[model samples]
Target chain A: MDKQMLRDTSRRISPYIHNTPIFTSHLLDDMTGAKLFFKCENFQKMGAFKMRGAVNAVLQLTKEERERGVVTHSSGNFAQALSLAAKNLDVPAYIVMPNNAPKVKKDAVVGYGGIITACEPNINAREEAAAKIVAKKGATFVHPSNDLNVILGNATVGMELLNAHPNLDMIVAPVGGGGLIAGTALSSHVFGKNCKVIGGEPLVADDAYRSLESGQIETNYSTNTVADGLRTQLGDINFPIIQQYVDHIIRVEEVEIIQAMKLLWERLKIVIEPSSAVAFAAVLKNKDYFKDKRVGIILSGGNVDLETIRFS
Target chain B: MDKQMLRDTSRRISPYIHNTPIFTSHLLDDMTGAKLFFKCENFQKMGAFKMRGAVNAVLQLTKEERERGVVTHSSGNFAQALSLAAKNLDVPAYIVMPNNAPKVKKDAVVGYGGIITACEPNINAREEAAAKIVAKKGATFVHPSNDLNVILGNATVGMELLNAHPNLDMIVAPVGGGGLIAGTALSSHVFGKNCKVIGGEPLVADDAYRSLESGQIETNYSTNTVADGLRTQLGDINFPIIQQYVDHIIRVEEVEIIQAMKLLWERLKIVIEPSSAVAFAAVLKNKDYFKDKRVGIILSGGNVDLETIRFS
Candidate 1:
């Protein structure tokens, strides 16, 4: 991406998004044999990195388009971000999710005063339902990732991280649709000294890693990871951006993800969900690479179904 | 507290503390009829305000005391904070907790690599056991609240709040052993603000409030509130400090505290231990007092006995 474009995005979005703290973890450093800085996007607006893109995309909408409102399909953090951002912008938000999506997510959308439309759990079903809502309501469809404004917004996270701790040797973040990592990589390179940006994916769904290696988007996965937030495939727009900016994609096992979750909760004393813990797992799985160096990990979110999250 | 001493403390302790976010609740503001700045000390070190003191106290200890190690009697956040801080300093930490203290608290302290010395529940038995251990082991005793270092550490939090959000018209923090509010009050004044500091207490164990009103310490409670952390009397150092700095004492009924906990958890999307929730409850209870004015409340800690904290 262009440097000026990214810089302008930072200025426009910084006020709307959260400058979440960068925390040092002595235990984390000792565990991985690396000086670890955790960029707590878990503390980001709407409690995740989704707020960056959501606010950016929402704020950039034309006055006429804004009056028509915005639509998206997300069962997790993005829903909350979009709902809250829409609420902030004094515009209507239409969110479509699976009927079986967690009650908490559904309720959060409704609670934030969003119009919720539920479909079947399948991705095709969600897309179809969201498209119907967009058509019927004349609302702008804000893709979960893929969109330029959304990517620009997510890029602000990297700017904040690199600005706060420029000596970061490398960085890791969970990659779902690749919006967060794309923004992180773009912004990290633009603002801070050149540092490797790593994308973490669960072994249960290692599409991004394979896509990265083969230089082609892979749609298939034999999946069932505790990191529900990272279950989606890399977006077309994000893949090209990741190819340009992200250095490597690491596939972490499910058990390691849970172990990371427990470590962050018990040691950091902060609530983090499995997707965010994927970055933790990536650091632990490849501890030797980070040894004695300054490594940064973005803890993307902390929304979890506590009763069902497998800590093992 | 001398000006330079406060400045020195602020500089010494700035690195460890999170300087956690202060979020304004548009939803809660609409509901409560006041502008609220929720100071998330729940994000603080050791998941509470205890870290501010624990780290400073450990840092301020004499070389002789460091050689001797540190000890404290607590069944809550202070235990974990001291354990974490001592671990950071490479000093031995011995916490004397009641045998019936939550397994989670014990697990957290030990998880942070601190040694625990379990004692009987009653204050007399607990103190006797702790004193005996201190005498036998020659460890430096860090009273949970009745210590100068801790009060000063807590004062820094107050200093931060005033510094970050200068327009804060008032401050309300839950009173446990009065360490947090006492320190905050002193720091707020030392930092040169006329901001009013208020103490929030649960009706079940209102010892600190009673002490302030009666003009003397009246120890007459067995700790019957859900806010397990705020059930103790203010310490000797804290008593005089609170009497001097705190502007008002607000009592939130037990039901109000519980209701507030539920509202905060549901709306804020953060799990706050009950004691921290009381400050929020006070702001809600006295909504009329703060209408159209900016108010601050500390979300004390989230290191909770998760199973025990319940809502109707």
Candidate 2:
């Protein structure tokens, strides 16, 4: 996507999403020896950056497509994001969630007006359930992170960060399904003055890191990280953009992820999920390189299950 | 004090404190059926509004008093607040704490340059320890929430809130040692246009509520509340102000406090201490009176032991 397209997508979804605030802490700056600016998407509508992409994707649909409604398979923040986005736009949303998904997640989606269709807790079952909805109900299937429109929408986060602090030396984001970092990299390349983009991945789920090194998409053998959002592999739509613009990937251990998450909660006084802490963990892990530089970290979401948090 | 004094305190502490942002949630507003504005003192420099009073008190100290240093007896956010405030002003801070205070609390004081003197957990022992420090060092004693200068300092919170939202029909603050509510009441009286002030107290530790009815300071026989910060009884210095200016006080159950705290963490995406939640719980408890009116709630602090949090 071009710069104009990113700008247009941001404007299109402006009314539906929040221009999330950037938070800074002197204690954190002293600890890490870097000027850290946290772009808090935790405060975004539906409590995640996914809302930006979801709203833009739905808005880009034609009248007929909008009339047919939308469908997505997710048990994470994207389910709530798409459901709320569709509800706001007066369009129906069908969510395909695994039956094993937490009750809180299912309840949140339903609370946002999403029509749920539960399937087995497997990729094949999820995809099959979503496909059936698209076939029977004439619904538009919207990929959470792989679609071009969704990537363009996520790009607005980086664009807004640069607009607020134009001289940031680097921007770091967690490499989840690769959509957020890819869009961030594209935004930095187009909207910033030499702002480099980096991706933070869980060492256990380092598909994006391996893919970059192998010059092709890679898959994870196991998803055993606390950063649950970063377990998914990269897709073709955003992988090329990430390869072209992303500076490099840094992998952090689960322990480091928890430490960073605790620090953010203690110092910044904001609630953030473990996945969002990966970006900050990467900076702390390699403090020598990031020290003395203005670094921007995207706190992707704050949809943690408070009941099950295990800081130990 | 008056409006000019409140304005002067705001100006004096402006350099040393954060003019913390106000947060709003559509979900919370919808849930309460009122327009709610949260004065986020949880984001204050020391993670509590105590910093505002601490800095102001230290700044107002005479040159001789400052040279001799400052001292206070506390086992909560005030220990860290005074330590950081004194450190910022290049003055020594001596903190007298119960020997049973949490290790994290002691570490925070030390981290902020406060010299700690441990004493028995009883109030008489705390007073004796603090008195010894005063006699030995000839330092100025700064009460955590009972001194005039400190009350003036805390009043800036309400002053700033009024300045931001002039039309607020009422403001709610949790009553602890009574400095915050007394100062908030004064600010609403002086700065607001017919605005009323309310106090939220834990039902188990409802000394402030009882004091208002008895026309004399009252003490809690049992401090069996989860809101640890509000267990202290109202002091003579702030009791008169609270009685004269505060419209009323609302006492909430411990379960209500936890529920409100959860809503803030889940919806507003901010970490607030249980004491802060008392005010929001008060608003929720009396929704009929507050409905359709503009209400402001002061989020008192964010200093919870993450390791020991038991939501159930």
Candidate 3:
């Protein structure tokens, strides 16, 4: 995507995105000896940063595309984001959520006036369902990761973070389908290469971790992280961007992600799901690099099944 | 406290406070015809608005007081807030919690490097335990509610709400020891009075509601509200302020508070304790006053026992 297009998209969507609070994490700083700034996108509308891309994608659709409606396959935040975004645009959002998806997420999407079609548990079935819907209705398909506008919209978060706290020495974010990391890395790199952009991955599902290392999209592994939001394999478009723009990638364990989630909840009083906590887990594991430095970490989202989380 | 002092304190604490997310409930709006802007203080630093008061109180203390350290008797949010704020300021925090207090609360206090002493569950026992600590350590006693700086700090939330959405026709807040409502009322009144400030009380712990009617601090009653934060009798200092500034006190049943808590979770995707959700319960109960007008509701805190909240 063109840099001018992304910049213009950032301007268009700046007013809509919550310049979510950036809190100085005292407990984290004491724990890691790093002056950390946390950009809490968990507090973003729809309980995730995906709303930025969803709104941008929907709002930019042609009148014919809007008339035809919109469809996407998402297991978590993107479903709710698209639903909420569609509500704002007064357009129909057709979401194909996994039948086994969290009921809370399903309810949130439906609550936002998005009609949902429950598909099979696997990614392939989900895509098949979404593809059939798009074909039947002739509606615009807003791929959660592949879309240009969606990536541009998420890039605004990185832009906003750098704008809010320009003294950042390093930045880290949780990576899933690579949409967040790709957008975040591109935005951060464009802002300045001096600002290190590291991607956080769950050791349980290190698809993106391997993808970046191999310099090609790798979708061989079955996901295992408690971060349901981070389960998807890297999308085709997101892989190249992330491979190019992102610096080092760190994979944290399931327990580490849970520990991070609990720590943020206890210390920062912010409820973040396992996926979002992956970034914090990275900082905790890699204390040497961040010690006594200004670091920015994106708290990606705070949507989790507490009951399931407690068990895990 | 003087009106000007309150404003000064709000200004002092502005940098520390999170301009928390506002969740306008479509369900609650439908239930109550009035549009409600829920000022989510539950998302505050220590999972409650108590942190505002605690930070303000700890920050305002003289260097001599800091040398002596700070102490408080609390089994809830106040304990966590005091511990966190004191730790942030490098001051020792001594907490006297009841033996029956939740493990989570106790863990949170200890996690923040606060010294904890256990006592029997009662107001008399709490004071007695704290008295022993004060006599031994000479720490400055920080009353959870009956303090100036704490109240003023809590007032900043009102200032922020008004700043974010200026045309609020009414502001509803939960009344525990009354620090939050007192500050909220004072700030909203001082900033502008076109908006009425209302307090929500649990029907079981209706002392504040009764005190307002009788123009005096009401006598002891066997209280049994799920709203643990509102179980305390209104403090002497908070009574006068609430009496002068509050428009009306609306009391809600325990079940309604729980119901509101559940609904808010299902819709808002935010974790809030029963006390914080009580104000929304009031709005849901009193739909007539809020129809078509913009109402401001404070989500006081979210430091509830997650197990208790989740199962219930």
Instruction: Please write out the lDDT profile of model 2 over residues A217-288, one tens digit for every residue.
Output: 999978899998887889999999999999999999999999999989888889999999999999999999
Report the lDDT of model 1 for residue B131: 91
Deviation (Å) of B240 in candidate 1: 5.0
lDDT of 1 by residue, B1-312 (tens): 776887788788878777877767677899988788888888787788899899899999888888788999988888889998898888889999899987877888998778998888988987888898789888888988889998888877777777888877888899889899988788767763577888889987888888888998767476898898887777778899889989988998999998898777655656678899899898888888878877888888876654344453
CAPRI-style docking class of model 2 based on DockQ:
medium
TM per candidate: 0.82, 0.98, 0.84
Give the candidate number with the greatest TM-score.
2
Per-residue error (Å), model 1, residue A111: 5.0
For all candidates, the clash counts are 1, 0, 1
In candidate 1, which residue pairs clash?
A: B155-B183
A1-312 in candidate 1: lDDT tens per residue? Answer: 678998888788777777887877666787889998888777676678889899999989999989999999988888888998999889999999899987877888898778999899998999999889788879999998888789899888777778778888888989888898988888877776778899889988988898988999997466687898888888888899899889998889988888887778655756677899999899899888879888889999876665464442
DockQ of 1: 0.18
Decreasing lDDT order of the candidates = 2, 1, 3
Candidate 2 overall Cα lDDT vs. reference? 0.93
Q: Which sections of candidate 3 miss by over 4 Å?
A: A90-92, A98-107, A115-124, A305-312, B8-31, B40-48, B51-72, B79-120, B128-142, B147-167, B183-195, B212-216, B240-245, B262-271, B304-312
* Candidate 1 vs. true structure, TM-score: 0.82
Best by lDDT: 2
- CA displacement after TM-score superposition, residue B32 of candidate 3 (Å): 3.4
